[model samples]
Target chain A: MRGKDVRLEDVVMRFGSFTAVQQTNLTINAGEFFSILGPSGCGKTTILRMVSGFIDPSEGRVLIGGEQMNGIGPAKRPTALIFQNLALFPLMSNWENVAFGLEARGVAKAKRRDRAYELMALVGLQGHEEKTPNELSGGQKQRVAIARALAVEPAVLLLDEPLSALDLKLRQYMRAELKEIQRKTGVTFIFITHDQGEALTMSDRIAVMKAGVVEQVDTVDNLYAHPRTPFVATFVGENNVLEGKISHIQDGFAIVETQQGAIRGINQDKATIGDKAMVFVRPERTKLLNGAALDNTFEVDFERRDLEGAFVNLFFKSDTGSIIVHEANLGQHKELEGRAKIGFNASDAIVMRSGELSDE
Target chain B: MNSLIRSYGKGLTGIFVTLTAFWLLLLIILPQAFMLDQSLWSIDKDDQLGMKIDRAYSDLGLLEYDAQQATGDTNPAVQEKIDTLKEEIATLEAQETDPPREYGLQNYTRMSSLHFSIFVKSIFYALAVTVLAFAVCYPVAFTIAKLATPQRAALLMLGLIIPYAINELLRVYAWLMILDYQGVINSLLAWMGVVSFADKTWIPFLEYPGSVFVALIYAYVLFMIFPIYNTVETLDKNQLEAAQDLGGSVFLTHWRVVLPHAKPGIAVGCIMTFMLSVGSYSVPQIMTRGKSGDWFSQLIYRQFFETQNWNVGAAYAFSLVLVCLAFILIMMKVFKVGIRDISK
Candidate 1:
């Protein structure tokens, strides 16, 4: 009933000659909702499988509750995995699907049914005990999968994008529901997803992975505010990137010279003079300069405007790279077009040593 | 009919409907009806009818000789005798041309005790073959469908289907060679010093009913594999991992998940195997090679060819057809699959 910490100590996984996951060390705290966020084929799912005992690391050890889990199978481990498709047993009714683990452990039929119903009720599925999984909707099936895993009282719960099949509204709704369930059960939930919004919304901490490496692992707020690498910066959210070289570094900030001109920003990576660097500023931080004397300003030709529900996205173009400015939907500046001046303060812009950016 | 026309237009649809009706009436329904009719009737041929006809012909010849000796002045008694002989010949010829037809189930009821035992034994042996084949094929089907990678699965499938490219009789003969008295297994046994061909003391595996069973199983194995493989292939792999993740043992996983999903295929496989095994004439005949008791199919063959009784042969053959039909129905019921599912 209590959560257990999962630690991967120098773990490496390989299939034939291809290494799926490199030597990596991670410790997930007990009862915390942790998420591994990455694009497809980035080895996040490999880490999840290793912790679930479905696979053994080729090199190092995986420990759960401070006990080595080298050769133990998934059935013997204290973890339950909800597959990407929410692989509920379609032949069985909802209650039977939930009770299968209990039935496997030799629980009486009546007790298993009752426990299944109780777990279903915990997932807010009180009256759908006898319906088959196909008879339910996508969101309902997601709840059933969670209840089924919870019925086993696994110390750690691993979910691999169980919400990916649901529609956007349902996916958003299930995020809240899953967070509530994790909070109530106090089970260590290791959620794997490529959707940054889902990870940012529900995770206590997030590990951003790329090509078999963990680039950064931190709380959602910190990951957003202080991404350690250029990949993390561009991947987690939309950023206006300006490629340039560090012209000067002083007073916790660096001045970067670009084709548009020199811009000053916070030096997160501490770039020295004459070093290549990239300045990243959030779209929302770029404002209409109007007449204010900001530290960094640019006059850009208007590209286009996209109207979102609560915000408007304004695209501006330069010779080097395009920039986007996010403006609140105030019903003002609806017709502003052509050349415009936009600016952000030096503290708002982050300058890091040039590296690989996300494709998006 | 309307749907067919709507789907394929009138001309092609007409051909389709006609071909289908022809197939139903000519291929399936008429042949069975003919067999049933043949099985239901018998001929009333008296044992002395041929002898009486022969006696009448000899008497007519004697009368002709006597008339020739009389020369121009015919005797009334002799003429009367000739006239009587002619009438007798006409009546006997008519009777020979159209014997009286007796309609009954006598053809089926007249099976001898030995033949009846053979019938029962054939059914049981077929059942055993079906069961053994299932035991052997379920694992193979599952492994190819779910466990092996795509290329390996394809390779295994090719291996399974290669033997079928040869004629079935040839395939059964191959097994006969492997299990004969001095066949492959016996020669291997001779090499091991258990039996010797020189002393004429080799194991007589062909004399046992198990040899027939081995051939029967081998002949119909693919019938069991492909159906089960097809159904198991459609199963979502995630369901398997989910069962394992939830702590279900391997046996429980198969019992609850994989087996349930494959019910229709299992039913189809069992039906095909049982029907093929029960009605297989060449397999048992080739394997047994007259050293063992006859299978029901062999018995039916003897009734037609050796015994020269088409009626009884039809009856025995019809009984087998009924056994197969009953087996199909039983399988459909037991597996809780509909006929549509089995066909698929």
Candidate 2:
């Protein structure tokens, strides 16, 4: 099946008095694996539902393949959805579950059976045609759900946290599997997930949402390196947030004066002098400098170190707040305790106007 | 037994076991066994036994009179005649005290063609009521279970159960009033100029079998709704949306997903509705009130109370039980559910 681009133009969703998704504009290109990443209740699933034709947007429009989709039920839409729980027909055999869409399309029983087996084999479930969904393992059931959705030849597939139920290892495995399937089918996949790791691993582009608003949408690398908002900076990955006000702005950089000291960072949001702002720096970007002159530096009391297999999370107490520095496990920096000197470059630190931070 | 003792101690376990056994013997096993035994046996009462007993009483009186008339004479012939009459009276009394019981299927086989037809008709009508009740209840059950908001579902449940607060017979009688010759529907029709009670031309709804069906369905509709509702309520809502998203029509979704998941509930509902309707006496008795033909339950009642033939009544009642048991089995098979599933 060929993929089709899905576009949402000035779409807004409201439930009674509560706004689920505020005015949003998005375009997911054909054959692209796009993910909407957010915390729970951020309206990512609401956006997915609107695109899948389960519900119409309260304002503006949703278009698929440049055709307006208004008043079309899910069954009549050129999209399919894989629910968070997989939602495989438990009483039906694996093949029957996969073939349900074909059956609905009035295909003959024999033809549906063949097509079901073919799709099952595509999902690597060739020998499990007659077993019911309960007889299969969690990952196998997930594949069956995917195969079932694909059987309809939908131009776009919407997945709502389909991997949230699987164990970590299985979840990681399914991420690659899903990416492979998307590539093979060339169907535009809009995956909604609260897990940033899953989105970073599987998505070609990710949209980070917060409080019914799209905070940032970009490639995973750009999202991590140049997050446009403090929420995105903290939500996508761990960051050391230093509260401060802009001391001055010059040369595409803002100098923020905090309780500890004045720190310089790239002015990502172009803050003016005396404006309330925060500087965000990735933990890995901080280095154990021995009083060396850098754009930003601080003296901190070493608290403890947490060894995470390939990396060590070193936390320190600064005059202002607790700071974390991520160090690669290179058989060094093991005797850190009591006191230390840390520093980072201006470009590695991002300064933005103060806004909502993610939940700690 | 060991687990019970381990869990509750010997004293409580002993009490529990004893009470359970007592209940089984007294309330369940003994009554059924006795009814079955009564159904299998009938007493062979000689038609002339009453006549012979009367004649023997008169003969004894005459013999006594003769013996008294003999007076002071020691007549051996009179004494011998009195002794012979006394002996004959003793034997007749013994015969009256105990009539021989013959055990066979005669009680069941002796049902007349008309009664047999009534039995068959009752089963078929009950089946029809069950089917119609299912058709009516499934939508209501689904709406309450899946479609309605929680408050709306609660309101609908209250509406369904409020009528049952009254006695079952009272509810049937209420239907009787609603469908009577000059009852609510007829009065409305009269107002609409379809018929007039003033001209003695009201519709005879009570005479039609449909009246019995309506009452029976109303009485047992909950049996069908609750079970199906319970099962449908447990079905994950996501499955429905998933089916829809996969391009399945509403009919296809229910046929493939919802119906299969509700098999056990549907089977249980059908069994309960069929059993209740097939043996329903009040619904037909009150609705028809002798204006229409009797149900099999009514015939069984007639055999016992009207004809004073307990054996035949037991036989007919047992037949109904067997038919219901057969229906339960058939429903289980048709729904592809087992006894364990049905109990759920």
Candidate 3:
């Protein structure tokens, strides 16, 4: 079955007096794997529920396949949802669980059972049609949930952190598996997750949300390389933030004066001179100076070092705040200690107008 | 036993074991055993024993008078007759005081056709009450368990339980007041010009067996609802949404998901309701007020109190116990739930 586009036009959701989602317009193209990435309680799940027809937006309309979805319930809509806990009916056999949608539609038992078997096989779960959900492992239950959602031939499939319950390895594995299934089925998948890594790994485009507002929506690479907001820059990945005023502005870069000294970075937000700004640089991009000249440099006393498997995080402390410099874990830096100079090129850093930074 | 000792030490363990054993024997086993023994025997009452004793006393008095009137040689003969008569009176008195007991199953076998019909009717009525109670209580239980907000659910539960704080007989009497000839419903009907109090043209609700059924269901509604509420409360809300998301209607969702999950509770509720209604004496007695025929429990009561025959009462009571046991087994089978699940 082919996928269809989903569009939320000026949609807003409010519960009682509390607004869960701000007014927003978004268009998800057909057959694209889109992800809404945010921290917990950021209204991403609210959006998923609205799209799945569980809750109607308090304002505006939700459209699927160019048809208005106002006042339509989840069952009548062309979307299916996979809950976070993978709510598989424990009393039913695996095949029966997969065929529940067909049964609801009044399909004959034998035909539905055959279709269930086919769908189960599609998820690589053959020869286990009669096994109950409790008899299977966690991942198998996950597959059964997916097959159940697919049985309805929905144009859009909405998943709300379905991998959050698995262990790290299984979660990483399921990311690729989900991506592959989305590719083969060519269904518009709207995945909601708080894990930026999962979104980056699986999504064609990612929408970063914060406090009931959509911060930015772009491709995975663009969202990471050129985040429009300070929240997105720090939330999408780790960043070293320096708050200061824009002292100078050039063609496309700005110099910010801070307690750590003057630092120049790309002015993505186009901050004017004398405006408050924050400079953000990835830890991996910052390097040990070792007398090499760079556009921006600072001297800091080494505070601590953490050894990761493939990378080493060297934490340095200035009078202002701590700055982490990430490097590959080579044997050269095994004996390094004390004060050191670290630097990064101006093009590697970004400058935006001062705004809220992520607390975590 | 070992675990008890390990948990509570030897002294408390001994007390616990002894108390449990005492409860088992005194509260459960001994009473049943006594009923069984009583049911097994009937007294052989000879209706002529009192007359025979009176006759023997009169004969002794006459023989005494004859002895007093006879001469020396004739007096000895008369004295011997008097002695024999006295002995006969003593034997007749003893027989009158303590009759012979015939041990057999005659009490069970000698049930009259009318009483047996009442027994069957009682069973059938109890079954109906069970089904109707389930139909009424299942939706209420599910709403309270899964639909209502927490405070509203608590309020609903409190409302259900508040009536039970009063005595059961009082509650049944309250139903009597509501359904009596000139009671609440009929009075309201009379005021509405549907029926007239002056002409005595009021509906007789107590005359129908349904009145007793309604009272029985109202009396034991909690027995049916609480178990189901408990089971349904534990169901995850996500499962419901998942079914709806899969296009399952409300009926299908409950039929396939909620009902299956609540099998044990439903079985328990049916068993409790059936047993309570079948053995209910006061509810039918109060609700019907002698307008309808006697229930099996009322028949058993009459056999003991009015008929003054404990043996037949025990037999009828034991029969009811057997029927309840069979019903429990049937419910367990139909619901596909084990005893362990019910206890939970």
Candidate 4:
């Protein structure tokens, strides 16, 4: 089978009366490292399970490799899912565990053994055939689970926050390993995780979900730099969100009346004047200008500053609300504290309405 | 004193520990030792005890005399038995006598008799019961562990345990009712005309070939179910799904993954059920009415209580214990696991 090309059309799942996912539509291209990102109880896992055929959609259809997957159960589906817990079998030897798929496919013992050894070697676990799941470390166990998933060569591999169980350092390492493995296997990966860093670092395209709805689905750059909705803008990355009423509109740019005086910003996609709108600016995009263009400026005392090795997180409150500004150190300029007037360019500010977003 | 000399304020704890250990061992293990010792020895015909001596010594007023020095009354046992015999022996020249035989290995030779076959039978019955109970319990245990949701599973667990809260004998008796000639099963069968009272006299429902086996197994089924269920509950759901995604069918998953994952559970359940069933007397006794359901425990009980022979009964009991231990050793080796592994 070709890699997983998943298309979820208006899918809605309900348990009893509570709808976990409502009207979610998304199409992930084949071989694209896609991710569904959400907070706890936001139904990201529910979406993954729906795709994997563990939980059927109550209302919509899921298509894999252009084939409709309505009645297809998890066992019959071409998709393989790596559970959040990475459920490796504890009793079987590592080789037997990895070779389980081939064994199930009626492969002979000796052949399956060879195939299993090859898979283990691919996963950097060559001599681990006799080891059980408990005998391996966290990362090695994860790789084993991945190898087990890869053994049958499914169309699409689904991961349900599989690395969430590991420690921070291990999780980071596994993220790279997972991406590299996905690249090497060339299998479509539909990764599910609430961790923003994991999604941003590994996904080719990310689908941010909220309350069983896809808020937005796009490439990481597009999702961050040009979010169509307030939820998307805030969820994709750290951004300074400000509520504003469009005081005036002229020629494609709107002058917004915010708590921090009046500022002019261009609307992304489309938004009209006199409309209650939301504007967002990235923390790193708020440049501390050297008395240059002064379209946006904040005169405030520094509440606190966090020196984060390469950059500093500056926390200061404007008349509107507390704002966080990120600044990278070049070793040329001294750290700013106490009080200063900072200004950001107008091009970096993006004004957007709340309605033009998708729950991927 | 040793504990005190080698210890401090914490040293007193060692003293207490040693004292407790000594008492605990005496309470639990000494009886088993006594049983083992009794099984190895038997009375002789003279004393009506476990084993006998080879040489004749004394009965009432008996004496042994060596005539090389001319003696009429010199009996060693008589000397120990009575002062009158001793005085009579002293009056003789006190010639050297033939010595009585020491201990002999008569009881070990008797261990292969028909009575000893009960031990083998107990071992056989227990092993079968364990296997049968495990077969019945595996699916239920797997469902409890993997299939059910968290909240509903608590109720299912309660369902498994509620029967256990009833009297064990009552549970065994319940099967008796189900298996009896005029019982529910027989009546239902007769009503269905599968086996008719009008056509034939003996329907053979209660007297089936495997009836006692059925009753004994039914009575001890729970012992096999719970340990396995507990063990499989921790099995990762993701691993099973991962196996499924990796091109494993349900059969493949179960054979290659699920069964292997559940090994510790199966091993533990088998061990518990086999140990308990092999030594149990009530279920077979009550259900089969001591007819064809004569378990080895009953045989041992008879040896101990019926014949006033602790030595033989203890021997039988110890033999059973040894067999059980052997079964456990075989199980551990067969399962290829340590006790710690299974428990985990």
Candidate 5:
């Protein structure tokens, strides 16, 4: 396709001896909203800056629209950066700000003014041209900054934590607004943030970064349902680990030895004997069924139960370990606190090698 | 009452203002009254009579009586001399009756003829100096406020303050050494073959009151530059970038964005520069050797000290003060902000 596709091949960035973003490789298809998600100081913004041409990759190269960005400066590159603070010019009228790029290109003033009006209307800011940046509310200013960046019509729009400054309510509201804008513009959006929920909610694909390296890059569903690494499992969504070693294997099940007992799990990989492994079970996937049939059950006393809007986070304080059992909508089960027995079926568990994830 | 004192202790503004007025009246007004009284009286530089003496001479009538009595002793020559002495005595005795009633509008009118012109000239000089200083200082001020690094910024600031701290005469004289025909600049030029050692090379430097403008402006330019610089410094750098990003060229950006922001400082600088330059006689005197460069101050100085006319001098000084006041008033109206705002 002629549309822009981003490719980062073996990219490494370092500050002094501290390597931030090391030998990372990822390719994003055109029109996909890819998010680089991590905790603070995980080198997510650094990667975004490199893609936007604000920063040069210390090693390797970045390709957009199948062209190598060797000598392209930020202005010349077909990329626009939205700063964390939004970086809206405070002194200009909203209309003038959007028309800035066209003015630079020696377009007639009337034509540029009209273009600004059109973009403002598209971003739901039609009647607010005469107002300065400070006069507009935070969300409005954000939309204006977006309009100004889009005025150039760049191939890839780089967002560096644009929603981090907003309050939680506003942040949630802008998430939908940003998605709508992305769809309307039809531009490749490369968003960088530290919020996992935000990434999962809006991104077509999510790349989890840790200590400057991309741990995994995949669709959010794949990341949530089947995490290849424990870091991804822990970061993408909450998944509990039951430490064990493969005791025996069967046709569709494997028994893993642990302090609780030899637990049965669906053997997805058919792990070898005496191979140290972990049984990864989602909190919701666990059933505390007292009256149903179960292949495996743990004789554990209950620690506590937390009731959220639609589910409960059940903490099981056991000698093996404190494992969380998330029960979705515990209706008519108010007496199951203080101490209880929990049971689950073999189909609910997936076993893995103990060292499948690095200590990072 | 104790609580009242406690509450109003820091709120002593009204009391402080009253005290200030008392001091101002006691010191400023009383001294000004004495000066005004002195300005009315003419001083005798010739010292024909004692300073306190107001009585006319009696020898004036005695000379005439002697001349009439001397038929044998006094010859035609003695008579002629006596007649001359009598005329002088009568003139002095007649002055005693009127007591040199040269008061009121006469002194104020005398200012109109000679010293008044100097007042007008001083105001003009000050205005020219303000305009000239603005042209020379704006670029330097802009550079210091916008571009200089912290250390270099300090140095640029020192560049302004160092020259200002020097006595204005010395500051002006410093320029004289550089601009003079045989001084440092000419000597350097002579080595460069631009002009010979024997050639009078300061011909261009004298063109259009160059020495006067240079010395006067250079001596006081910091006064103008700092005020403008102060205003421009806090100006948001983002504003300039925004203007450019909004399609303004360099000149348009300065006009539409930067100049309006710096208006208050410009007004303050203009007022201060104009006030100082018009009243300054030393810089122009030293730089131009007090000859061809005689501005209005020279005339006022001559009127008060040389010609012994205090009335005309006061009138001239007053007129110049009034002119500056009028200009400041006009400026305040144009800027539409209080003086205190710009001063800060």
Candidate 6:
């Protein structure tokens, strides 16, 4: 089946008196794996529901393939949804569950059964046609749900955190499996999840949401390397934030005056002088200095070190806040830990106007 | 037993077991056994025995008079005759007092064609009531379980249960008032000038069998609704959305998803409704007020009280029980649900 682009123009959603999604404009390209990443109650699911035609936007228009989708119901739309719990029909056999959409369209039993088997084979479930959903493992059930949604030949597939129920290993495996299926089918997949890693791994582009507003939408690499907002920088990945004011501005660089000292970073938001700003540096970008010069440097007392298989995280107490320095576990800093110096390059850190940070 | 003892201590466990056994024996088993025994036998009473006893008494009185009037030798012969008559009277009185019971299946086989037709009609009417009740209740149950808000669902449930607080006979009587010859509907029609009481022309709702069905359905509606509501309430709402998202229509969604999940509840509802409607005496009795033909339960009532034939009544009642049991089995088969599921 060919995929179709989905576009939401000035969409707003409200339930009674509470706004679920603020006025938003988004366009997901055809055959692209796009993910809306946010925490619980961030209204990412609301956006999926609107695109799937489960709910009409209270204010704006939702269009699929350049056709207006107002007043359309889910059944009449060219979209399918995979719920978080899988929601497979427990009483129906796996084949029957996968073929239910065909049955609803009045297809004959034998034809639908063959189609169900074909789709199940596509999802790597060859010998599980007659077994019920309860008889299958969690990952098997996940594949069945995907196969069921694909059987309808929907132009767009909406998934609502379908992997949150699986264990970590299975979740990671399913991420790749889902990405592979999206490629094979060439269906526009709008995946909703709170796990940034899942989005970073599986999505071609990610939209990070907070409350009812979309904070930033960009490619995974750009989102991690140059987050436009403090919330995005903090929510999308681990960041060592230093609250300060824009002390100096130069060509594509700004110096922020903090309680500890002045630090320079890339002027991503282009804050004017004397305006409040925050410097965000990634843990991996921050390094332990050994009498070497860097754009931003600080003296810190080592608190502890945590070994994480391949990498070691060295925590240090600075005058302003705690800073973490990540290094490969080569067993070099085992004995010398009382005092240390940490620094990062000006190009490695980003400076943006001060805003809300994600508590998590 | 060991678990019970461990949980409640031996003394309370003994009491619990004894109470359960007592309930099983006295409330469930003993009555059924007695009914079966009563249905198996009929008392055989000779029609001529009473006349013969009267004749013997009169003849004995004459013999006594003759003995009193005769001389000594004739008196002895007359006394002998009187003694023989007295012995015969004693045997007749003994036979009259304790009639012999003849055990057989005659009580069951002796049902007339008219009564048998009523029995079959009652079964069919009960089946119709069951189907109609299901049609009426399934939507309401689904609305309460899935569609409505929690407070609204609770309010709707309370509305459904409020009528049950009154006695069942009173509920049937309420229907009777609404469907009588000059009842509420006719009165409304009369107000609309459809019919006039002055001309003695009005709809005879009680004359038709529909009135009884209406009453029976109204009386046993909860039996069908509550079970279905309980099962449908447990269904996850996400399953419904999934079906809809997969391009399932309203009919196909319910047919393939909601209905299968509610099979056990539907089976239980059907069983209770069918049994209650089939054996319902008060509904037809009060609704028809004898203006229409009788139900099987009414016939059973006649056999016991009016005909004074307990054996035949027991047989008829047992036949209804057997029919209901068959209906339960059929429902279980049709719904593909087991007894364990129904209990849930």
Least lDDT summed over 10 consecutive residues: which range in candidate 3 chain A?
A: A328-337
Q: Name the better of 2 and 5 by DockQ.
A: 2
Q: What is the interface RMSD of each candidate, in Å?
A: 0.6, 0.7, 0.4, 1.9, 4.5, 0.8
lDDT of 3 by residue, B1-344 (tens): 89988889999999988999999999999999999999988877778888888888888888888877888789888888888888888877777787778899987888999998999999999999999999999999999999999999999999999999999999999999999889999999998999988898999999998888889999999999999999999999999999999999999999999999999999999999999999998998888878778899999999899978898899999999989999999999999999999999
- Candidate 2 regions with alpha-carbon error over 4 angstroms: A290-293, B46-52, B55-92
For residue B185, give model 5's deviation from the true position in Å: 3.4
User: Residue A329 error for model 4, in Å?
Assistant: 1.5
Q: What DockQ score does model 2 reach against the true complex?
A: 0.86
For residues B1-344, could you state the per-residue lDDT of candidate 2 as single tens digits? 99989999999999999999999999999998989999999776677888987897888788778777786666678788878877887777777787777899998898899999999999999999999999999999999999999999999999999998999999998898998888999989998999988888998989999999999999998999999999999999999998888888899999999998998999999999999999988889888889889999999999899988888899999999889889988887888899899877
**Candidate 4 lDDT (Cα, 0 to 1):** 0.77
Model 2 agreement with the true structure over A1-360: per-residue lDDT tens digits: 999999999999999999999999999999999999999999999999999888899998999999999788899999999999888888889999989999999999999999999999999998999999999999999999999999999999999999999999999999999999999999999999998889998999999999899988899889988999989999988999888889888899999998768999999887899999999999999888966667788788999988998999999998777899998888777887777888899989999999999994
Task: Please write out the lDDT profile of model 6 over residues B103-161, one tens digit for every residue.
Answer: 88877887899999999999999999999999999999999999999999999999999
Off by over 4 Å in 4: A126-130, A133-135, A165-177, A269-273, A332-335, A354-360, B1-23, B46-105, B111-113, B196-202, B205-209, B341-344
lDDT of each: 0.92, 0.91, 0.93, 0.77, 0.76, 0.93
The candidate with the higher lDDT, 2 or 3, is 3
DockQ of 5: 0.16
lDDT of 1 by residue, A77-96 (tens): 99999999988999999999
> Which candidate achieves the best DockQ against the true structure?
3
lDDT of 5 by residue, A118-215 (tens): 99998899789989988998889888988887887878888889898888898899899989988877889999988888999999999998878788
Name every residue pair that clashes in candidate 3.
Answer: none
Query: Where does candidate 1 stray beyond 4 Å?
Result: B1-7, B59-92
Candidate 1 per-residue lDDT over residues B278-311, each given as its tens digit? 9988988888878778889998998899977788
Which residues of candidate 6, in runs, are more than 4 Å off?
B46-59, B66-88
Superposed model 5: Cα runs more than 4 Å off: A1-3, A6-28, A51-63, A67-72, A226-232, A237-283, A286-308, A311-336, A340-360, B1-182, B202-282, B291-344
In model 5 chain B, the worst 10-residue window by lDDT is: B48-57
Q: How far is candidate 5 from the true structure (C-alpha RMSD, Å)?
A: 6.6
Q: List the residue pairs that clash in candidate 5.
A: none
